[model samples]
Target: MTRQFTGCLLSRQWRDVAGGVAIDLWFATAEEPLCAHVTGEQSVFFLSADQWPQAEVLLAGERGFTSSEPGLRDFSRRPVRALYFPAHRQAREAARRLLEAGLEPLEADLNPADRYLMERFITGAATLEGTVERAGGHLVMRSPRLRPADYRPALRIASIDIETAMAGLELYSIAVHGTGPGGAEERRVFLRGPGTGQAEVQAFPTDREVLTAFLTWLAAFDPDVITGWNVINFDLRFLQRLADRLGVPLKLGRDGRPPHWRPLDDDGERHALQVTGRLVIDGPEWLRAAFYRFESFALDNVAKELLGEGKLLHGPERGEEIGRLFREDRERLVDYNLRDCELVSWILEKTGLIQFCLARSNLTGLAADRSGGSVAAFDFLYLPRLHRRGFVAPVAASTAPDAPGGFVLDSRPGLYRHVLVLDFKSLYPSIIRTFNIDPLGLVLAADPALPEGASVPGFRGVRFAREGHLLPDLIERLWAQRDAAKAADDAPLSQAIKIIMNAFYGVLGSPGCRFFDPRLATSITLRGHEILNRTRDRIEAAGHTVIYGDTDSVFVWIEEAEDDPAAEAVGRELERTLNAWWRETLAAEFSVESRLELEFETHYRRFLMPTVRGSEKGSKKRYAGLVADDNGDDRLVFKGLENVRSDWTRLARQVQEELYGRIFRDEPWQDWLRAEVAAVRAGERDDQLVYRKRLRRRLDDYQRNVPPHVQAARLAV
Candidate 1:
């Protein structure tokens, strides 16, 4: 009997079977974990019909390969034919032969497993329909039919941390804290020593025994996600090395398969771990990907910042402390190790990072654990749409013309009161929606066969099709979803949609993306340039003074307004006026409806647009403002200033904040500044004088005239 179920895709892999390649997809459903075996799928790539003659001769004797016309055309409008192979290896080999023979192959580098999902528009969630057979603890689906579905799995997460000797050669203990999905909570530590009387602590006589026990417990618990601070590079890598020395397999996968470890770069200092049916996510990596910024990514620091608690032990001497605890205080060592594991779990829970990851995956069709694949995500969303439009994208260009960036209006520097900030909501996305900017649109618009009114003029002598474009409609859909997410108070989903929607412009602008074209990027940015300039002119004509404008926001001095509410009222009027003007103007001029929306974002009672540090010229991005809260309390906000910069010394930042606050509030500041300088000169503020900066390169790599921080680093080394 056939069964239908929805499951969230956890992992995917492909293997060469007897007759063809079989894609093994593991999923976490509401009921249980399951594996689906999809066979009889061919690995395919496309080639220009004109080049098929030479390609046919090159692959004439190749077995298990066939060629056919699939009614697809390349970006250059040339008819393309698909080359199919029973296995990925065979297809890759044929593509290599064709390349060596000086024939270009299209979409040859795409992974077969990724292609299967992308073509079906399947992201992380899918609905499966097929025959199911129960295995020991899981089920196996044979040749399931899969389609995209909205599903969020309740995954079991294990936060694991290992304590080793200072040199990292000897393992002392391994701690595991499991949460979610499973009914029972798990907190256990396996230490390499005599058993402790504590219920959560288990001790073994040898390192191998401890490792074996930990592995056994882990396999039994079966977490879908294994997380910790730098877990992949430090904990997992150390365990793999120790396991190799102890002649034991590090079976971390649900299928009892060892993780596949691969170096990420030529340096080999960093590695990526792939476990079958499980995700190994490092806490810091995913946090950064979610746009969390911190002074440091140390587990203790992050835990303190996010959870208001930190590790049991902290500081540079933590390693030594662990060692001492291992020899003299095993129980304390176990507690410390377990605390670290718990801290990782707490951090993840506090930030809702797992939910954010799932939301991002649902939007981008990327692996939930994957980070920094904006280009890949773009491909996943765009390629299928392009295919349906009867076109295939060209490979990423090796080189493309650099596109101009956003327009920053020249500032009229001054300290002023009642300055209101107006912002264009999602400016680039709104422009995309208004202009129908798309790769397929750009290509189709250039065809003379297209009707005259169906095309709109773009920058750099390019045109865009008014209809049959995908990006505009896609953005519209996401924009509506984001609105709904906001209304429902789902911050993670809203943030995910925002990040993906904002990434569309950058993806088109980047040469790394297959759909990248200079015309497409410039059309958006140059149009923005036009919009900003015109908006500035209109604002100035309305008797308000425009002090500064950067990219999407404009600062206006409302001279007629005396208080914050009055300034905000003026801002609201301007917003409505400009929005209506844009709608009418775009419809009249470009014969298109405008999605442009200008919003009154903030009202600053006092604002400062500072000049260059040593010049009278107005600075572009540096500014400060005082905003009054609803409670009638004034708060100082800084941008591109020392008070907000991470590299600046605390002394400078504190002084700047105090000085700015006093100046904005019209309070006495001269006496305070003199006293502060005197205190600093007298060594009273010496602790605040130390500059905290991160070194981006090795100390020895600094050659030429080095910066002060680099010099200090070299001296310390």
Candidate 2:
């Protein structure tokens, strides 16, 4: 019987069956987990029809291989044919043979499971209709027909943290804290000990017992997401090693399968972890993916910053402290272990990072736990649309020409009053939409059959087809959805859309993406350059002095405005006038509707465009300003300055903030500066003189031009 169900995709993988490969897509619904077992699908790649004769001759004797005309053309506009094989390995072998014969196989590098989902245009949420049967604690759907759906699953999350011996060779305890289905709270700690008196703490005789008990508890809880601070690289990795040593299988997957670990680099220093039906989301990784920055990504630091609470123990001596607690204070160790788990849970909850990850997955068709996959995300969103448009992208180029970046005008160094900032909203994306910049559009515009007036000019002798583009329409839809999300106060969805939209330019410019083309990237950036220059000219023509401009924002000195309201009125007027001018100008010049939006972003009562440290020339990105807060109190803002940089000393940041604040307010700063110098001379602020920096390489690796941090590290060594 065919039954329908809606669920959110959690994980997907493919395995070799008897005669072919079968894709397993795990999903989480409101009531239970389900695995969609899809088979009878051929692994395929495309080749130019011109090369099809040679490819067919090369693979003539191969069994389970077939070829067909898919009616698709490559980016070069050459017709392409599809080569299908029964399994991925055979397809890979065939592509290797073609490559060895000096022929190109397009898109053969894509994972089979990813290709399956991307071809179907199914991202995260999906509705499945197929024959279903109950397996062990879950359902398995055979050959499910999947379609995209508007569903978001409320995932059961478990945040786990483990305690280890000082040598990191022995596991001391494991703590888990999270909510199960229906929001029921659960907390438990498995301790390897001879003594225990704390509630929710289960004591076992040995490390193997503790590990086994924790795995059993995890299976019973059945969490859809498993998260922790540095979980994959530290805790999970350590547990995997311990389990191997103890001759016990670490079964953390919902399907009673062991976690799969793969080294990310040649050195094996980092690993990627995947479970059958769960996402292993490391807290710091997801936080950075969401653009959250902190001076330190340590659990204690993040917890304190986000939750106003931290671990019971901190600092460099934490390892020794944990050992002592394990030996003498087992109960305290339990508390500490559980506290760390709870802190990770609270931090993720406070930041809404899980929701943000899910939102990104739903938008880009990437996995919910995947991070830093801008190229893959672009492929996930673009390839399906391209295929539907009767085209296929070539493989990523081995090399791509450099593309220009955003425009940054030289600054006019000065301390001025009533400076207003005007910015282009989503400048790159707006450029893409207004100018019809796209990979397929660029290809189509060069066709001899294309009408001259049906294309618009781009940089570097390239043109884009006006009505044959896909990216502009995609961005327009995302823009509208973002607006709706903002109206509904859906911050996660809004942020996800913004990140994806902004990443388009970079993806096109990146040599790692299959659609990489310098012409497409330069078209957007150079267009931005043109827009900023024209905007600056217009602002200056409107009787305001253009102070500084960077990328998408322009700072104007409204000297004639007497107060904040007057300056704001000028800004609003200029915004409206400039936006209207752009609309009319683009329509007249290029015959395209302008999506360019000039927004009045901020009005600083006092603003400063600083000069270079050792030169009279003004700096481009360095600036400071004083603005009014919501309560009408003055607030200081800094950019590209010591006060906002983590590598600078605390003393430098403190003095810079104080000096800038006093100067902006027109207060007596000379005396304050003298007092601060005197205090520094007297060693009153010695603690603030210390600099904190993270080393990116080994100490011995810095043989030339060693930085201060490297010098300090060598000394410590």
Per-residue accuracy of model 1 over 100-216 as CA lDDT, tens digit each: 999889999888788989999899889999999987567899998889998876689999999999885699999999997755679999988887798998888898999999999
lDDT of each: 0.90, 0.91
Pairs with steric clashes in candidate 2: none
Sequence-dependent TM-score of model 2? 0.98
Compare the candidates by TM-score and give the number of the best one. Answer: 2
Worst 10 residues of 2 by lDDT: 178-187
State the lDDT of candidate 2 residue by residue for 254-343, as single tens digits: 889999999998878799988999988999999999999887888898888888899988987899999999999988898999999999
Candidate 1 Cα RMSD (Å): 1.7
Name the regions of candidate 1 deviating beyond 4 angstroms.
Answer: 182-184, 630-632
State the displacement of the C-alpha of residue 138, model 2, in Å, after optimal TM-score superposition.
1.1
Clashes of each: 0, 0
Q: Which stretches of candidate 2 lie over 4 Å from their true place?
A: none
Model 1 clash pairs are: none
lDDT of 1 at 133: 94
